[model samples]
Target: MTQRRTPSGQGPARRPGRTSRPTQRVRVRDTSSTRVEPRVARQARPVAAKRTAAQKGATKRTVAPRPRAITGRATVVIAVLVALVLAYTYPLRVYLAQESQIAKMKQAQDIQRRLIAEKADEVALWSDEEYVVAQARERFYYVRPGETPLIVLNDPAGAARDAGHAPAAPAADRWYDTLWSSVQAADSEPRN
Candidate 1:
């Protein structure tokens, strides 16, 4: 017997030199009032046509979705967030500025404290009699009572004059007369 083959060639294979047999027909009794319709024959389609038909069906079923519009609730939430940010901006800036000012004030206070400590140390040093004597002796050439004072001159001319070898001023001309004469001489000179 020859085997029936499907259009897709997935049916059982046919044997060579076999004769085709007629299929048996079964008759069924009508049990319902519904009428039966005859089946329509299907034609084989090309692969490209089948693919295009499948693609058309897929496109019809799966349409591209449109972008959603913003809802009222979402808009209100975004507006609230923006308002919150705006409200916080000034306060945040002020807080940072005040913090920087506070830091600067603290630095100034630290510097003042250091200066006060230095002054206190200087006062403590001044309270010592030995340090005071040493400073006075070094700065003003002061000496203790009953101590002989000896002054050393740096200029050789001043040293020679102090030794009493220079000529003395005349008794007739007082010190003021000499000073006046020098001033008059300076006034008489021509200016550059």
Candidate 2:
């Protein structure tokens, strides 16, 4: 609302104005300097003088603007992906390993069940009178009461061949083992 008087005591009421350039507005801003830069100071700036010819010949100047700054979306996406993978990696590995272990345990349980069933069948046979008599005759070469014992010739070489490699036993343990065998034979007998 106020017309700033120049240092030479003139205001905007005069005809001398900054209408020389069309686009470039040279409004006299309220700077700290009392006067505009002198001609001597302008000539001292050689860099500005060298651009006078280029400014006159060019209608448009190609100015490369600065690249846009990075958005935070890419950083957020990478962080989320990293966190998701880190959160699931341990649990995924543990689940897979446990699944594998469970499969092995199932297989082992099936084998143990089959072996236990076979042992149960053997125990059932041990309670039969015929099985008890057969085992005593074959494994122990036992004879019935008042019967003469006759050795069979089948696989006679197998017993003598392995005899040298057989472990030695104390005579006291042999007597105890014979007593245990007689008890087992009595126990293996069928109930009336």
Candidate 3:
């Protein structure tokens, strides 16, 4: 029987069912020629095996990195910021309200100041004797003790009648004479 030799030419051929150790490929340079070659020719793996190895390597390279979880320090920082805002909100609102109230009070004070000035001027005017006397005479129709009071009736008789007061009759007609004349006229009239 003839024995078959392996491709490396240093071992007996492997049987189809027998397991053997894997071969390592080593590169060698040919000094005579400028080309490089493998010292021992490697056996080709099956297509399915080659594809699975390639897919595993590709998945390793292309897989995305996992997202990192938030650290305790970062959480604490955010919490502190939220707490600070909550703490200051009420005080800020109160400060603004007080400022507005102060402005309103100042406005009311200015109005009061103006009123006081006007009253002061009125009081000054009343302090003068001549101004007080003039106001009293004009409003109350008062006169000095020795002064002759001449009352002028400038309005027409029609104005007096419209005001519900008829013009006075001549002073020559006494009240009794007018009354007797009226009685005689009434007696002469026919009864209705």
Candidate 4:
């Protein structure tokens, strides 16, 4: 290794072919001129000793003696809170269920009341002689005096020979007429 020193004598030496390395300029304390007090020297302790003292103090404070009464009280408080929540849950659920049932029953009662009102109105209408006569004429074809009832025919030839006597009426009209005739006939029957 070759050492090439600077002519000024302050900077470090540089190698022949390589770049010069940077040197750190440290400021040294002039201890020969400064005066030190004995009290300040006694007060200063090493950093490791200071840290150990702080850690010992923290450990002493953290490990406090807790009584059994405080721990038992905390456990009782938690249990009571849980019991209160559980006790309220059942009654709350039952109340909600009953409320829903009441709503449904109210709706059903409203429907029933509406039906009863409609039936009562129908009964009132039936009690009127005009309404009854109109119903009998339209439904059963019960013609009054001097009123000719004309029966319109569809496939009269097919229907003519089918019945041994007269031409049969359309099956639909006959069914309704027969039912109405039976009801009227029953109402006219004398009760012994």
lDDT of 4 by residue, 1-192 (tens): 534445443323443565644576977788798986665454554864776577643322223355576587799999999999999999999999999999999999999999999999999999999999999988998998999998767986677678655765656667788899999999999999
Clashes, model 3: 0
Instruction: Write candidate 3's Cα lDDT for 22-141 as tens digits.
Output: 666966666786765677886776964876577642322233456569888989999999999999999999999999999999999999999999999999999999999999888877
**How does candidate 3 score on lDDT?**
0.79
How do the predictions measure up, each by TM-score? 0.44, 0.44, 0.43, 0.44
Best by lDDT: 1
Write model 1 residue lDDT over 1-192, tens digit each, in one string.
544655454544544574555566988878598788898896655864876576532322233456569888999999999999999999999999999999999999999999999999999999999999999998999998999989875886677688978755546988899999999999999999
Q: Candidates 1 and 2: which is better by lDDT?
A: 1
Candidate scoring better on lDDT of 1 and 4: 1
| Local accuracy of candidate 2 as per-residue lDDT tens digits, 48-135 | 4676465654333335556567658877888999999999999999999999999999999999999999999999999999999999
Each prediction's whole-model lDDT (CA): 0.80, 0.76, 0.79, 0.77
| Deviation of model 4 at 18, angstroms | 44
Clashing pairs counted in every model: 0, 0, 0, 0
TM-score of 3: 0.43
Ranking by lDDT: 1, 3, 4, 2
Q: Which sections of candidate 4 miss by over 4 Å?
A: 1-74, 153-192
